[model samples]
Target: MLRSFSYLTDHTGFCGTIKNSPSDFVVTEIEVTEHSLRDTQAKSLQKPMEVLLGQSSPGLCAQSCDGGGTPVPADQGLRWAGDSCPASPCQNQHESKAELKPGLEDASVLDSLLGKAVSELLNKYACDLKDVWKSKSDANAGTREFSLGPILDKKNRADLHSAIRQKFPFLVTVTKDNEMIVKGNADYRELCQFVTEKETSDFFKFLDAKLENSTFSFEPDGDKEHRKVVHHFINRKFGKLLETKSFTVTDVNDQQNMSIMVRFREKGWSRKRPAGGFQEKQDLYTAFTLQKENLETLEAISFLAAELGVLPSDFSYTGIKDKKAITYQPMVVKKVTPERLKEIGNKMEKKGIRIHNIHSACQHLRLGQLKGNHFDVVVRDLKHHSHDSSADLKKRISEAMENVETKGFVNYYGPQRFGQGQNVQTDQIGLALLNEEMVKAVKLFFTPEDTDDPVNNAKRYFLQTEDAKGALVMLPEFKVRERMLLRALNRYGVNHEGCTKGWLSIPHSMRIFYVHAYCSKIWNEAASYRLSIYGSKVVEGDLVFSEETDETISLNDKVHVVTAAEESAKKYSINQVVLPMVGHSIKYPGNKVGQWYHERLSKDELQTCKFRVSPLQLNIPGCYRPILKNVQNLSYFLEGSEKGIEIEDNYLNESKVSLHISFDLDPSCYATVCLREIMKCDF
Candidate 1:
């Protein structure tokens, strides 16, 4: 109900903070290692982690802080040892001791050597560091429990304190101890708005108990429900959790690179060839990483198949990686000979498609079968700079990273998920389709934006005049979807009844995307609203998913009361809050959340039951999304980088940084959403 941060102090340790710009935020993917069935389940059951592959620069892993505040130059710090240290899964540690020299001990003499400006800078920010330290201590030692909450699974745990700069910039503390969050089973107590101080005094008293694995449980610290009646508040904020920071990301497609390796998912793939290479059996699989320059997977495969005299179907990929960015993903060729594949790979590389690790396997790949994607990204050319000093930049970055790392960032869908032109507008037209607004859907499809393409501009005149047939005539031959809609309208009239039929004429996949997008919009909106109202708290009548493979709970498994559920949910990370994805056969959550869903639909004049139109078989049963996203192996570092560009603008500058970041997310999680919280800017 309230956040009280008065308890933290410099006397106790904390994770320090630093800031980063999108100068060179490099994200490299860490492909999950293949495992046996037992290993797979064991890994799945392990607690989730928010650790990412983190290093401030391409090189330069900093050493852990020993609590006393002071700057350790790159030459002296263990983190900067780079190759000598285990940067990957860095143990932010004081593994090495500083051999203090004379004169440096005197702050003034050292300041003079570093320059008066640098000296003044340290004086300006030293107190700020203490405050940051105190705030962390408070968050760690008081109101908020010290547990990492699936965030501490990072291998860098013990040494994070040493790596965090305790002086200016990175002021966050790094402590090795953890406090258990208040769970239902803790010295747990519920405090409602109606309670009097006397009735709730006992609950507040437990705040002083030994917090670490105390194994202490007690009764509701209240003696009675006070006479005053208060309403139970539910989270109802309406927006994504991403902050609003602005930085430019260039060199995006500069080197759209991707290197992928695949493990065959089929069994009995050991067939060998007479020439020492594995013999290509019909069921044999060949796993490889397809690295192509400026070519989509399909395009790359198509070109290769043409040259090799094989159908593209000979190559089966688990999923498609981004065509624009340098991506790496595993792929397999079913029943393919290694020799022939090698020949194709050789020819393919000459054509800009470089295939790596084309080896035979016993199994084939299934969609979403691999562990997770690894990202190596570089955020470049930050336009805005409040200050040019490295100290200032690091300080800002430290603060942001500390906040994001600790509290976690908001999870939201980025703009790329939405299609161009009226196809998908945060699921607007899709919602219209679900609502059965035939005329609305058709009109929206024809609605041209200000930056209309030439094709769209050509059709705009006819569409604006309500001449559907004329618009169809203006559509180019390549406008397959558009022509289909026009043909339907030409046959049927131009009314809602006619347009509904026209809407049905579009490809089923395309139409379903629209519907799904709309559903996503609903989810985003609902999630935002709930976070605002409840601030990530559990409430009465919520439904929590039991497993990744399990679908949403049926109506029969609903929670009808609040009682101790809040404490239980908070303890187990089972907030039970979920939103419907706007589909038929989808049973929405119960109580306030469900009511809120209905309210949202009523405002949009839509309903889940309305997703039953057969025109395009858009009748998809919906899914549910948890309000929070689990992040694994979160780590980051920022350093001064030379890869920058200057622009003549109000905020554009030439300063650049290579903020190295690495993490693994579930298959459906959006990396953009996570980065948004850090950059707080448009990608």
Candidate 2:
């Protein structure tokens, strides 16, 4: 889709082109430091009790509560008291059944307070817990409630409740007017079953049985959202029990989905503590400054991973820099020694990548773990307006720069987010993934356009003959995803399952790119519409982060919607107004802008609620982005001969001007979008 740019400043924009060469677009990441992290942690510790207690707020946390008690360590496992082992309600119900009988004290207390018949019924209900869990849906399986007929004596109810708690710690009990209510925790049951099944089953009989010393992959049977939920459930409940790496994978339906590979962690893994108080000490991670020219961040990392003999997932960076740029950023690698990295750095330097300033870090770098990026861009082949002299042009450009510095520019995502050329767009593939049209997404991703490259030829060959092995022979080694997918197709057959297995073989980050690009498209359009309609006005229902909130916290929990009273009182400024990126969790504006979001989403056959892909375990819990971003340290100058400059053709001579511009943007802000505002021309 063609992107529309809306400007916040009314000043006329001059025409220019950026990123003519790799050196022309320079980027330097402003990385987060130990001091900043300490400050953030301190602030978090100081949060009000109410905010800390209110965990249900949007974006506060995704994992469900473990029922408000000390979590049992994974290694300790659940212990069943011998006395509490109850007989199964039906002997032939299932080959294996859970034993959930009350202890002697529990039975005696219940029998004395509520009679033998009532106690027997409770025991029978508890015995059927396993069957109930296996039969119920995820939503209903999470919790089960049982109501005991009301007893007149309050003391007896209290005694019964205490006895049940001792026998079944997973059960929560409450008494209301002598009516004792008992509820079973699903997470508790799941954990117990997981441990029991693993212990009882033959180690050599499972799919992961042979993977004793290596990570074993597990593909949950569900959509993306459901998969994600399951992943979180596993992480929260069994994190100590297993070390897992979760990534996007294609399912049998050829749809983007989630899968996790797990391996047994060392004994007492959960007991290990994180580095505390920023004390200088040796660490497992090596942090270094990485400088690269004309290479995408992932491409450089992939090359480095090959040279280092490590997986790409072992390395982490603060952000993805522009592919066609001289960029410097901090990168962290786990378990790799600095000395070893320095050895590889020499080889990498020949490929336009340089590593330096290596040091030990307590933790690995995460995406967006940076303050912002400083840009030194050179806008070349500037075209002046008709009849405008160099002086007039200079004057216009200066005013435009000042206008942006004061009023800011619309924070639209850059064109690179959507991919280049007139072929298939990344967002199109992403939309297909979101719409659960896996076949279409797969085709859009793997099916080559009418390009004459060898890779395209290979793809065409594969499509025509369904010969993955033949295509693999012709495809270049650098075509990682293509080669990997073909191998999977060859092994699994050229079918839906094979296609999904092919996606699973590719890197997780690459798979997420398409979905994120789709979100970026919606964001860019929404931002344009916001600026076009509001024109820097902060209206009622406009969302803004609270004054005390850190802008770095890009979640809905800290977001506050402007009330009519707040708007009338002029409490928020235009810069504070933010727009949603279209997700299931975000709140839309209450006015026409909000209505427009729904309408636009509907056009794509999407709703805010449908942003989640349950089968793929992808949850697009959208976050808010500022509609306007202030230009920091903005400055510019024009360069070029007055006569004219020779164009690329060498024959055509045009009066070309180059505008050298420099600025800093907050992390996640697109410099190209900012340039679009100054030049007022699509690159």
Candidate 3:
């Protein structure tokens, strides 16, 4: 069955073709980082500074003296000066001078100067600083600066600088207005000095040692534009290892003005602790950027796993990339060394896969961990109306692109969400599973289609002859899921229990993918119905996220139905409207659209409350998705047929033109759906 999707733009979209060649489509993943995850962790770690310092009472500072110093009220602004307290009147002044004595190496001095909270946080990484100073023979040992997270008080900042200079003579302090930077002085090497555009390889060599937790600083020789290129190059090469931060530094030749300085250090290096002290557990997963041409994400990972003698389940990634396109995504594997993966990757160059930027990751890659995907798509063989000239066609295409950018597009799951081929619809198997018809689902899996592929032929042979062994012979080796199911059926016989076993033999991800595809189909139909009935207006029955809804909240808990008063007041915009993916726990719209969901579910002989299957352990509590998605950084350019033809012996006619469109979509949004809006044709 063909699924119809609605478009947000009203422009008459022209016909254009995509995926003429694998190179015509390129997808690059935008990754999530530790800095982004910190916001999610902030709410859980909400203890006050005094609590971290182990203070018995609130507003009491931890003392620096051997025996606990006399408790002074926090309002007095008086602190302990070790043993040299002359009197209460001059106690504060005496404490400051005594604490600033040269060669004073007490860690408590840091607590007194920067407050108990900041001192404890710094102490957690004190091992990193101590290691640098201890390693005098190390070439990479150098001055390392740590940011004291924004201090707005002028006196507090000045106190921090003075404390570092006097108490710790080996350390130097500088202030960028209100922010204090504490730098540890040690022997350093100029790894790459005055690096020009042509000498990027030297910079890469320096980055190669970054994995060993080395720290170094270099100033690239360039203007702003050239430096920008160098920055991009560094990110592309050493993104996983480099903990990059931009700061202003006085120019080496000209001290009057400041220049942009980028600091590079190994990720998570600062958090290391001294030997036998409390330390973070080493990461079990190794993540790397997997770049491939004409290979599915799983297929590439499976190939690598097979080469490395590991299970395919050992690898994880944020999302699947297109099989027929050049794609780059981050993938992680548990207990695998970067060296082993790199060795296998070097051999995979001939197989259209290249892996790089390998590093240790604290956790496995999870779905929806990426910001989004950036697509560079080339649409060829553009057809024009008979009345339109080349210029007119280009003008219309330009207008369509602008309309898509301004009005957005329907956020429908693309056809690829459903498995390829017309012989068996993946959603049918999903529906059978939900209904507890395991035998029926298994039969559907083996259902013969019109396609003449070898896999289908094997399925037909197996169904007609009941010969699992024979079918296995004809099936390709790469069809792991099919082989596993057949093997299970062969051992258990094709009965109810056997079919259940066969279905369970498939990977959990693949099984869940089928059910999600069914939910996506329902969502696509409901979204089209909504646009047809209610145009672009925010209706009273529509659903929008509540004011309390945010990234930290669970998806199922974020739904809020639009009320009549709110709709009248125009509180929610059309873009804010969302549709449920249809589940037992999901709440439908309050109007005809909600009723439409019931009718649609009734047609399938299913109920919203029946999404859970206890025997199969499949509990799909569906989530809400936005009905519309906006395009970011959308731009397009027209190319003549002869200019952009990737395949030399082109099949397209001389009149054919290519439209190169580039844009970014948020996570879980499909680029093909956006292309459907631009072309007004099913992909």
Top candidate (TM-score): 2
Q: How far is candidate 1 from the true structure (C-alpha RMSD, Å)?
A: 24.1
Clashes of 3: 0
Question: Where does the lowest 10-residue lDDT sum fall in candidate 2?
Answer: 83-92
Q: Using Cα atoms with residue i matched to residue i, what is each candidate's TM-score against the true structure?
A: 0.48, 0.63, 0.62
- Which residue pairs come into collision in candidate 3? none
Q: Alpha carbon lDDT of residue 385, candidate 1?
A: 35
lDDT tens digits, residue span 379-448, model 1? 5444333433343444544555565556554445444455423343637677777777788787777777
Q: Which lDDT value does model 1 have at 266?
A: 14
Ranking by TM-score: 2, 3, 1
For candidate 1, the TM-score is: 0.48
Root mean square deviation (Cα) for candidate 3: 21.0
Summing lDDT over every window of 10 consecutive residues in candidate 1, give the lowest-scoring window. 56-65
Local distance difference test values of all predictions, in order: 0.45, 0.64, 0.64
Kindly list the per-residue Cα lDDT of model 2 for residues 1-683, writing each as its tens digit. Answer: 33456777777777767778998999999865657755643433222111211112222321100011232222312211110111111111111111222242345767776679977887777767656666766646635678886756654554565456445545556544345677775455554543443422221111112122223445434455655654576667545344454556567887865555444432212233333422232335788999999887888887887777777777877577888899999988876888889888778888899998998664565432577899999876666645444545666677778888887878787777776663788899889878877657767776787889998999888878889899999987656667777898889877666766666676766776788789889888887887778777788888886543222123554567788898899888987787877777678888888998889888888864467666555667666777777878887656555524322332112345677789999877789888877766677
